[model samples]
Target: MKIPIRSECLPYALILSFLSIIFYFLNKYIAILMLILLAFVLFFFRDPERTIPFDEKSFLSPADGKVIDICEIEENEFFKSKAIKVSIFLSLFNIHVNRSPISGKVTYKKYRPGKYLPAFKSHASEINEKNIIGIENEYTKVLVSQITGFVARRIVCWSKIGDTLKQGERFGLIKFGSCTEIIMPIDTEIKVKIGDTVKGGLTVIGVIK
Candidate 1:
């Protein structure tokens, strides 16, 4: 099995492990606890390679988490029309990385600073601080938003406007705990539902007819 740890967490894990080593000289019990926490921090950021579906008509999930909601909304920012929004809520245990759902050129990218509401709340999608990426292919434009939660303070995006992204390619991640959203055209067929478990890059979220 190929275990790919996201490079972003190395500095954090190393720092915590180093502190644990120092704490060992002061108190063995505290040192042991810190070591255990370090292990979890490393695990939280683990980005394993997945067998993504090779389908040109399918849209994949952007983050590893549970499908908290599926709703229809007027997405005024990008689509400027009706769209089906699939929201995934990530806990501390879920992988924080985000991926591209389709192979397309990034046509729009925007970062909005706002409140850090709990990601589980449906309104977090609109009100929370977020990084929005819109990818466009010949058929349609898809928007993926990475939003901050109560605890998550950082949103990292690697793809910029005009960048070409292959399906299931890594684009960015939300630090600690957050939410990811994939907004597709209203007429698209959704493959997943509320409460369904999903894995980033591997799970198919919707299909274009």
Candidate 2:
């Protein structure tokens, strides 16, 4: 059991636990409270412990949640244009680790510090705390934005702007609960529909054009 616990955490479990303990002892009462909060954060941000089974040949869902929306939006990244937007909403109980949807080189990565809105609200995409990752795959470009919800306070992204990523690779994690938006080329086919439940690194949400 202890082995499995350590395995799931990769190399960060000990560090996280050690910090949690130190924090707990420094402010016993507050630290105890934070430890409980940390436990919930660990649980919610937990990454699934299985291979997605898809080779670098297929596109995968970047998040584990429900597809709340699919729309067209004005992309302000490079060209300052419009693109098809696919939004996935992560609830407090949903896993918050985000994966790369397709193999590509990250072209743009920016973080916007903003307000924490309810993930279910329509304005959350624009007004909420979020981090955006734009990738260029061959001839196609896509944007994946991690948006924070009311209960979410932290967003973690591991990939740099010039780093290369394979399909379904773990690229980032959002603490607590939040939402993510994937913007694809206008011609890209959306494989998942609104209300469909998706799992990170496992479910197919779209394909590169």
Candidate 3:
């Protein structure tokens, strides 16, 4: 059977597995603890396939989490206009993999290093370490921000500027709990509200009007 875990997990899995084996020979109880951690590492990195919707006008959620905030904001960084921002807060148990919300060519990419705070805090979005990616289809442009939380320090993005990405394609992941924000045109018809649970690539976040 194919391993459902992301490839980025192999090194951590191998290290934990090796430590568990070595501890087994020296201390049984410690070995058991290592084994438990190994299981958690596997679970945390699991990447199951998702069914992406085919509608061209709807944009999917970029991360699996709960919608924490949705409001109008002036997106001067990319869109440079009034836009709707939807923020998703991912817990430790939520899937960390991030997906593209629409099929488009990567037009912008920027990485900012900053403070680490709890992702649920409103100010965290502005001060936390983050990677910003802008995908533009023929119709509209969408920006995805992967923000690191107190426990999440690593942000991985595989797609780069000028690369073409299909709707719901895997692009990157946060190493632990984090936050993801999607900024769309002001005319976008928001489909999710705050506190709504969402699945990356599976939940329609908004409709392009």
Best by lDDT: 3
What does the lDDT come to for candidate 1?
0.92
How many residue pairs clash in each candidate at the backbone level? 0, 0, 0
Candidate 3, RMSD to the unseen true structure: 1.2
Q: Candidate 3, which ten residues in sequence have the lowest lDDT sum?
A: 1-10
Question: On a 0 to 1 TM-score scale, where does candidate 3 land against the true structure?
Answer: 0.96
Instruction: Residues 51-122, candidate 2: write the lDDT tens digits.
Output: 765644456788989999999777776537877888898888887788988888998988999998888799
How do the predictions measure up, each by TM-score?
A: 0.96, 0.79, 0.96
lDDT of 3 at 123: 96
lDDT of 2 at 12: 46
- Estimate the Cα RMSD of every predicted model relative to the unseen true structure: 1.2, 4.5, 1.2
Question: Which stretches of model 1 miss by more than 4 angstroms?
Answer: none
C-alpha lDDT values of all predictions: 0.92, 0.78, 0.94
Error of 1 at 85 (Å): 0.5
Where does the lowest 10-residue lDDT sum fall in candidate 2? 1-10
